[model samples]
Target chain A: MFSQRKFYTPYTSPTDPCPPIEVKSYETPPQLYLGFQPPCLPQYASAKEALHRGTLWPALYSPYESPYKRGDTGE
Target chain B: MWYYEKKLQYPVRVRECNPRLAKFLIEQYGGADGELAAALRYLNQRYSIPDKVIGLLTDIGTEEFAHLEMIATMVYKLTKDATPEQMKEAGLGAHYVNHDNALFYENASGTPWTASYIQAKGDPIADIYEDIAAEEKARATYQWIINMSDDPELNDGLKYLREREVVHSQRFREAAEILKEERGKKVFF
Candidate 1:
């Protein structure tokens, strides 16, 4: 003797609501500290002229000389 | 006026994105001591400055406009595909909750725009000093934002911004020196 059994599969709709999503929170790390040197003064004869004309100022000008003076010597 | 044209001092290329970092950079656009304020302050102040200092201020002021564009672009790219959920996750609470997908013009903390950020007193000496302080403040803010972001792409942009602040500060200092020299030569009663 043999026995037969019936089974049905339920249909899932294509437009069914999405299942709740579980998202893992991401932590933003603290920003790192870094030091930046100031911008370098452009070294050019014309820039030196501009310095003399008060149009440019070299970052490392000697305190003794007016920015306009032109000499390698600090004085 | 005879017209002359000049090209961009630096190339403006499309940069990579990290949406979270972009939101903070937006402060430079409309925030206190931001590029918009810097540009307006210099340009407006130039009017009352002596002829000697006016050109320098004008040139620098114009450059600030370019910087404003750069910041805005960085923000746009960062936020391009940002979903509301991601925005909220990124701690851009105000942007997500209030503006939806719209990018309203606001400061870093999402405050509305104001003219109080700019000051253009007629005195040239006063103006130049103000310019120096403004540049330093902007540099500091850039540093603070750069600290907050971990994205290298964002960091690159921030570094460039910070460098520009340094350069502008030096230029303004030079301008101040020029003003002081002129005042020194003036005959006083």
Candidate 2:
């Protein structure tokens, strides 16, 4: 499975006052991987789950976890 | 004619009062790429759009209004019991002076919303592209909001709103494809 999250490193100056973040992460929406939505794609087992996730199709669901949280980036 | 639904499309829950977060949430409420701009843009553009995609416009545009209501509920809950000092510290002093605790159509910086935020060229390709871009922008805004928010319950609602943007963008892309396929086809009675 392709990751919806993407990452990058920014140039850090040695003289900078604050510590530079080694890696910065951003998200890519699922639609970028899809050209057009196909018919009869697999759906969530329950409509309530779909409503909670904000998407009925599992393929289109891209979860966003806050990068600020410890270990949220899977580091 | 549209029928009024008494409930929000999605339930909004605010775990606590945080005027600062409310200030940030106002961006989606009335910012350039906010829900209000999105709703009006599609609703107005539908009249000039092609027959096949007009219903899509109507549906998504109407949904944006529901999203707007959700945001309004959040803002109301966040600021309802907040003191003026808290509002000032939250960078909403200007807003407090003008609207008090009532919600106003303004961005986080208190800039009032304007129609200039949206455009309709009357071209199906052009307009649909705009809609897709708008959804992506709103999605990004929601993500940033989640990043700034400390309220887990609020993040739940924000996440849902952000995901809706993804779905809406895909639907618009599919609409574009449908329009493209009809480019040179002729219908005979």
* Candidate DockQ scores, in order: 0.02, 0.75
* Candidate 1, A1-75: lDDT as tens digits: 111111233455666597522221211111111112246646546854543322233432211211122232221
Clashes of 2: 0
Report lDDT (CA) for all predictions. Answer: 0.65, 0.91
Write model 1 residue lDDT over B30-127, tens digit each, in one string. 88889999998988898889898888888888888878877877777787788877787777867878877566668877887688988888888888
- Residues A22-52 of candidate 2: C-alpha lDDT, one tens digit per residue: 7888888888778778889999999999999
True contacts kept of 2: 0.71
Model 2 regions more than 4 Å off: A70-75, B186-189
Provide the lowest-lDDT 10-residue window in model 2 chain A: A66-75
Candidate fnat values, all: 0.00, 0.71
Q: DockQ for the candidate 1 complex? A: 0.02
Best by lDDT: 2
